[model samples]
Target: MLTNTVTMTTVEIAELTGKAHKNVLADARKVIEMIGGLKSQPSSLGYSEATYTNKQNKEHPMLVLDKHLTFTLITGYDTGLRHNVVGRWIELEQVANPAFAAQAITETLNELQARVNAMAPAYDEHVRKGRTVGYSWREACRLADIDHPDKLLAVLVSLGRARKTTQGHTQLHPDYERDGFIKTLKPSNLVVSKNGGHLFKITSKGLTEWLKAKAEEMNTAVAFAGVDRWGRPIK
Candidate 1:
């Protein structure tokens, strides 16, 4: 499995190599000492002391090593054991990269196109003739293939189209509103006072012109953002 940490513990190394944790710890210490004591040339040794809790809830000292130190420490091991460690290291490194994740999201979305089409019937015609209108915010999001309002807000923000307030209501950017892509709704009893009693919705032009472009853009943005450390991608 992929791990966020760049370093590996001697306990995990022992598991991978089918050795005792105590033995792995001894080997790690020897490598650390050969390079220099932990206090000297620490960077080259790439090790740090940590602790692990046992079944009895007692903490015991352990060593964590970065990739360089890990491989150096394992150099004396047989070929199969070294391969196991190398395989696990590759898995950990992949956690930091998002190219594969983006590709996966793209493929998933493509596979769901048929279902999206069935749910959003006539959406294309409405956009093509420039007559799209009368959709509530939720309906608009559904037609755009965005799974949630929050996800839609993320896509809009990435496209420089909208923003959300600290109070958690999303509002279109002034430039977009002025361009006739979106309009503010009159305050109603259902509107919350915290948002100044106003709600925003896409205009006819927005549904036809703006949303058409944004739907595709949302695909790319969702794929990239899905793997971003900040948020998950829109399904």
Candidate 2:
């Protein structure tokens, strides 16, 4: 399982946090200095200085921080804003590890197809209506063996894959939406769309690609790989 070393630019950090680039650059340098002096091998240092072209095509200096360094740099920020950076890092990781992510999605799709096969009659009805790409969140939790939709939503929010609104409705996290794991839709009877807000539908890929892994990691009974829609034991 090879993974590329992912890095985030201080400029991007500025954009993410709504801060000035120069301020982010200064903060990054301070983080680098506080950690240690410049090393001969920047790769081992977790941060490196680079230049970016400005509006006038003039090169301006910036710092590129690795994952660990990025988290350290954002430690002082508000939790909500810090989440912005965290989401950005997740995107970078997916790009840096596309093979692993793609393989996961491919495998999840297979398992979902198996489930679809088991529910052929119902599935074919959805296929006929051309609505087979995703499952209503309620249906998603049911298929995953979650006892309650809120319980599943809580788990997803805890894992940073979903967000709970002040009104108590659950929305798919931006990171998951960006990665095509979940989609937001207008309120409908097919979904548990509360408070007249958008409903969340977990894409089939999301059910296994993202939710399954996190659920298993947390010891929650999500969709079991190699099992049909009925959650038959997969020994």
- 138-232 per-residue lDDT for model 1 (tens digits): 65555555555566667777777776566556677787678787666544535435433325766656654566446656666666766747665
lDDT of 2 by residue, 56-122 (tens): 9999999888877887677655555666776667666677777657566456445533443454455
How far residue 93's Cα lies from its native spot in candidate 1, in Å, is 0.5
TM per prediction:
0.39, 0.41
Candidate 1 regions exceeding 4 Å error are 1-5, 40-44, 100-235
Please tell me which predicted candidate would have the highest lDDT against the true structure.
Answer: 2
Q: What's the C-alpha lDDT at position 35 in model 1?
A: 47
User: Alpha-carbon error at 91 in model 2, in Å?
Assistant: 1.0
lDDT of each: 0.64, 0.65
